[model samples]
Target: MSTLTHHKKSVRAMAQHPKDINSFASVSADNVKKFNLPNGEFLHNMMSQQKTIVNAMAVNRDGVMATGAAVFALSYDVTGTRLVTCGADKTIKMWKKDQNATPETHPLNFKPPKDIRRF
Candidate 1:
């Protein structure tokens, strides 16, 4: 089993609109503008997806690296060997220092918005 799944503590969380992954001001602004569409779905996509960035990372005794959700909060065990993360998906994930914990993105397959007129 993966180190994350093997953790003893697990909890359900509430999803929230997380911060942007783009640290550079220009890139983040351009993206926000480029992706800001009249449709709400498009806006939501840009905002939530960026939160999947790796905020924290740790290397274990075996020298393997692991990461946590970027925009969300992070926690570590007393020894700093185990890590925990809360992401926009509202799930708290845990991983050992050696585990490769990466965020998975499920893209939204959406159609362009269509305007409706009154009959």
Candidate 2:
């Protein structure tokens, strides 16, 4: 058996990578961090728009991830290309990866929502 102790805050959720058994994600505060299996090596943080504690998470077969917080629930489409999140605000948001955007462009091109309603 192995143990992972990297999270500085309380871990609220966890999800294994659907296609990669060697890795998994854990949510602490507003950040989702990735870690390797068995070895417990810290991988990296997944990009997110959440500003509060994450309550649930899931990974689809195509590696797409969905995370929910507050009164939200998240899920991915069958194709794994789209992620949908429904929240307490009675709104549903869809997210998809921009194929044309590179890592360098992502930071500049990505726009966060102006307001995130939390319960």
Candidate 3:
């Protein structure tokens, strides 16, 4: 028998939050790493802290979804509602932030449909 190993892809996009100076990046390892850029230099070992997986990334807009992630098809809406994400899992999700939300959680939703293709 033979064994196969797959490697996760590197970061897809790196963007700075328009509302804040903090840096945000989505790595293919299913993680959205956040960091603070004191200067131009990137701080090291920051990913080891959160140790979470994101896969995709999007910014906040008009009191809508702030951050979202998936395996693939990551979309960032700079001036709209809903952060759309589609992945290899053959699914699509729409995340949004609700104004009347509570702490430790933001109002967001997802839709599981067939794969979505965008040009």
Model 3, span 14-107: residue lDDT tens: 5565555654333335333444555434332223212344455555543222333445556656556657778767988776767777755754
Candidate 2's TM-score reads: 0.59
Q: Which candidate number would show the highest TM-score if scored against the true structure? A: 2
Candidate 1 local lDDT, 1-119, one digit each (tens): 21212112232221122132221110121121112212222222122123333444433333323334433665555555777777778788876633443344434564432431110
Error of 3 at 48 (Å): 3.6
lDDT of each: 0.34, 0.73, 0.46
Off by over 4 Å in 1: 1-71, 98-119
Per-residue C-alpha lDDT of model 2 across residues 1-119, encoded as one tens digit per residue = 77778776778778788878898888777567888887889877664346677877878886756666764567778887788887788988888888898777766764655442211
For model 2, how many clashes?
Answer: 0
In candidate 1, how many Å is residue 104 off?
22
- Models ranked on TM-score: 2, 3, 1
- Estimate TM-scores for all models: 0.27, 0.59, 0.43
- Lowest-lDDT window of 10 residues in candidate 2? 110-119
